[model samples]
Target: MRKSLLLFGFALALLSCNKEQAAGGKEFKTAYVDTYKLLEESEEMKDFTNKAKVKEGELSRELQQKAKELQLDAASFESEARVKGMQWAQLKQQELQKRQRDLGIMQETFREEFDKEFGVKRDTIVSQMRKFIKDYGKKNGYDYIYGTGEAATVLYAREGYDITKKLIKELNEKYKAQASKEEPAKKEEKN
Candidate 1:
């Protein structure tokens, strides 16, 4: 009887504490951003994509021209080799082989260089975006900021809870400010 009374008293105290806590329940503020929309609508992203495309096209054209030139040279060498003596033809063939090897190495090196530079640029952009979102969430008193993309990790979010536009606007403003600041520095360096 004594143990049962003690247990009942403890249970009553727990119930009272729960009632007090329930009166002061905390509500979490959460928001989600459409990551794909963010990237698509971002001015900085558009500029970067445009610049990258132009550079890629130029590089591809240069590479293709180099390949075409090499092909033409090989064809010319082959035509000459038939008329030339066997010994001369052998020497020319070896020279053409060396040139082909060199071209392959050059192409490989160019691809690696372009990929490394582009990858670094892409990674930097993503890192900056993540940092900006984290800081934005903290500044706005958000408990959780989730990212939803084409893959649809967040199946559904209310329109009011979608912060993609505001976030992209802030990001673009920052990017423009930074770009303007850097442009003068670039001109000064060039001079």
Candidate 2:
């Protein structure tokens, strides 16, 4: 009987505490964070961009060579057909068309490869940045967060409430650490 009474008293006390807490419920405040600048300042981003840029020339040259080869094959086909028959020029035109089609496919493939490379390199950085932003928002007790990107629709935000610079610095530091962990090739030195 004593144990039952003690348990009942504890339950009542808990209920009273809950009621009192409700009376002083903490309200969340609204604030914003800029993702665009955060991404721009990140070290991981810098490495990914630098790597991609370094490969740009090679990729372009390869594409150009492929195009040149296709053109040569097309011209060879055109001449071969012309020597075969009067209707051979018509056949040569068909060959030219096929060359154009092949070039288009090759270029598309090259573009997709480039895009995949960029995506693979940057995916982790973007994921980390998202988590960092979420944690920052919660830690700062912000009820709202948004961007100031080029197409940012949420305009007219208060100047004092902007956490853009702080977020950017933190993101950059985190990105740099992440990139260093990956040991990405230095942009300046090429082996």
Candidate 3:
């Protein structure tokens, strides 16, 4: 739904820009791209996903070791003992299942955290880009500004029009500044 609106708006922006340009002596140029998708494609998201996978592997290994320790067998295996063994196996299976469930919950929590942090970081970066674009457009006589995201109707855009690299660059700068400020505040609160 969000992507659809963005695409529709993008088409409208282009049409509006062209209409305004043709109707008057104005020349309007606009472009749209999804900043979030670009960020997800970045190495940072890959690194985060890799870390989560490693953690899951470690958890699985630990659970396996635990299961081995608990996989005990009695010397005189009677009918009752066999039934007890079956019950023990069932309980062990449940324990393994619970561990998997916990691991899944942890992974979900990490993904949510990553998404939230990425969203904030992307928003900050986009905000900085928007400021620059606004100033640039105003000075260059641009009449309208549009945001590009997953659902923008723009099937294709020129490389020159893609401000993604510029936005990403500006975002890292903005993120570092914000992180620096936040770190000092965190340190002070801890003290």
Per-model TM-score on C-alpha atoms: 0.62, 0.50, 0.40
TM-score of 3: 0.40
- Per-residue lDDT of 24-90 in model 2, one digit per residue for the tens? 5844354444567778888889888888888877888987997888778776875677678768778
Each candidate: what lDDT? 0.74, 0.68, 0.61
Best model number under lDDT:
1
Write the number of the candidate with greater TM-score, choosing between 1 and 3: 1
Better of 2 and 3 by lDDT: 2
- lDDT by residue (tens digit), candidate 1, 1-191: 97667656654653454345222485555566778888888888888888888888988888888789878988898778888878988998898788788878887887888788887887788678877887887777765565656443432333555799999999999999999999999999999
Which ten contiguous residues of candidate 1 have the minimum total lDDT?
150-159
lDDT of 3 by residue, 51-73 (tens): 75676676667656655544432
Collision pairs in model 1: none
Task: Quantify how close model 2 is to the true structure by its C-alpha RMSD in Å.
Answer: 18.5
How many clashes (backbone N, Cα, C below 3 Å) per candidate?
A: 0, 0, 6
